[model samples]
Target: MPYAKLTITVPDAVWIGELSRAYPETRFRVLAATADVATGVARIEITGEEPEAISEDIRDYDTVTDLTVFESDERMRRVQVETTVPLLMTSLQNSGVPLEMPFEVCDGEMAFEATIPQQNLSKFGETLDGMGISYRVDRIQQDVESDPLLTDRQEWLLDEAIERGYYDTPRRTTLVDLADELDIAKSTCSEILHRAEERVLKDYMGDEKGARPTVAVSSD
Candidate 1:
């Protein structure tokens, strides 16, 4: 398998791209999306100071036939909409690459991480190019099947840590914060994350010397 991370600049003609450019500060997290031959549906979490206004704007797009707000607050709004299929998504479908869901779009760019068949990598790139979708491959690595690499709890905790930026440079969140969020003891959280990280690193690096550098999971 091949694992890749891609950043794509959405064309302004697309509704989501136009909206992202209009409100550069807003973050659109597409939690779920599906498309068929005639229509597409997307469930998005819009986060910003004026999510209400943004939701209103989404309803006004000609391609959006229906928009339903499921939740709203001062900083975020969750909405589902029926609209035309996005070209980027169509390209992915054509390329036979499965997208990892819950991707983010901000400042007119969308980020995607996917694990695909080794033979499909070039086809994926070609499909994107053919659709006129501008994209940059952030990274591509040979990967093994990851499903059996970690326990379910370990995998869930790792996802939480990454989503909260616990692994980011300079560290946006601390181990203590993560533990608090998960309602677990700090030591337990650290232990689980450490074990998960070790398993992932070992699987990825194998016998490559110096490839498995220590990761400090604690920022207390």
Candidate 2:
């Protein structure tokens, strides 16, 4: 089936644009986001550089009508922000796209990947247009489901490493640090990360015969 990965630049009304404007230096990753239609509120888990700083910054936005901090660590946080604005997540759902998890928010943009039907691509576009939302199609291609990418254990290691900031530009954490956290050998951690990265690249690129077109779609 054909799939598309979208990197959408949301409006200032949403949390991504709002928090990015407030705290440009810190990175923000949305671990989970759900729009409760009945309540007319979006409950989101925003993970970012300083929990306390973000908490203080959030108070400035009237759009975020409610806030709750579920957990925090030195590197990142998992807090719930209830907002009144119509969210990009909601927009995607309204479009009927099957979104992938662990989307991110940074520099006023939200990145999401979804497996959408080839015929429904236009439907998705029309849905976004109807919602009056602007977005960009980062990648759209035919997915190779037959080929398995990473093993469950490798995926776990990669997810953990990412959460620990091992992939940060300056390298917030090291392989040694990750190993210590997981109580495993440094060599083991390195092996898993390397292998996982390889699989991710392979999957992203796809096989030569199965490679599909990649177009940059933007409302601008």
Candidate 3:
């Protein structure tokens, strides 16, 4: 299994792409979407200053057959729309790749993330290329297991450490301060951080031989 993050530049001819380009400041999050061969439906959350105006504009598009605004306010509007299937969605459907929902589109670019089978990754890329879709693969994590890379506790501690500048040059926070803030002992914090760092670095380097260098932690 592998995890991939892609940034796709939606063609301006597509309704959603055109709308996003028209309102560059607005964010369109496709919370849920489903499509067949000819038709597709998506529940999208439009967030910006003028969601009402945006919604109205969407209804004017000929491809969009129906648009229902389920929720609306000054800052956000949630709508479900029935429309002709976009090329990206069609490709995903045909390739049998499960798209992680709640993906975003802003200024005609879509941020897509998915966990895909290693074998299907190349096929997916080829399909996108065949459709003339412009895209960039931002990241790919290969051979990821069913379990997550980091444990919950490790993730929480790592986040705290980074936020506190433990990894910063001329580090702003020490192991003692970090442990104290989390109500854990200094030695325990050090051990947990070391384990977390090792796991992350090893995964990043793809160093199966485990010859990666160790990071020194200040006990102070």
Candidate 3 residue spans exceeding 4 A from truth: 146-220
Query: How well does model 2 score by local distance difference test?
Result: 0.73
lDDT of 2 by residue, 1-220 (tens): 7778776776777756867866766667666667755333433444556767777677667666777777777756666777675556667777677666667677787777777677677787887888777888888888877755778989899999889899889899988888999999999888888899998887666774376666789999
Q: Which of 2 and 3 is ahead in lDDT?
A: 3
Off by over 4 Å in 2: 38-49, 147-220
Given candidate 3, what's the lDDT at residue 174? 88
Candidate 3 has an lDDT of 0.89
| TM-scores vs. true structure, each candidate | 0.67, 0.59, 0.67
Per-residue C-alpha lDDT of model 1 across residues 46-165, encoded as one tens digit per residue: 999799999999999888899999999999999998888566567777788877789999999999888888778889888888888899989999886545889999999999999999
**Segments in model 1 whose C-alpha atoms lie over 4 Å from true places:** 145-220
Candidate 2: give the clashing pairs.
Answer: none
Q: Pick the candidate with the highest lDDT.
A: 3
lDDT of 1 at 168: 98
Question: Tell me, what's the RMSD of every candidate?
Answer: 10.2, 12.7, 7.8
Q: What do the candidate models score in CA lDDT, each in turn?
A: 0.89, 0.73, 0.89
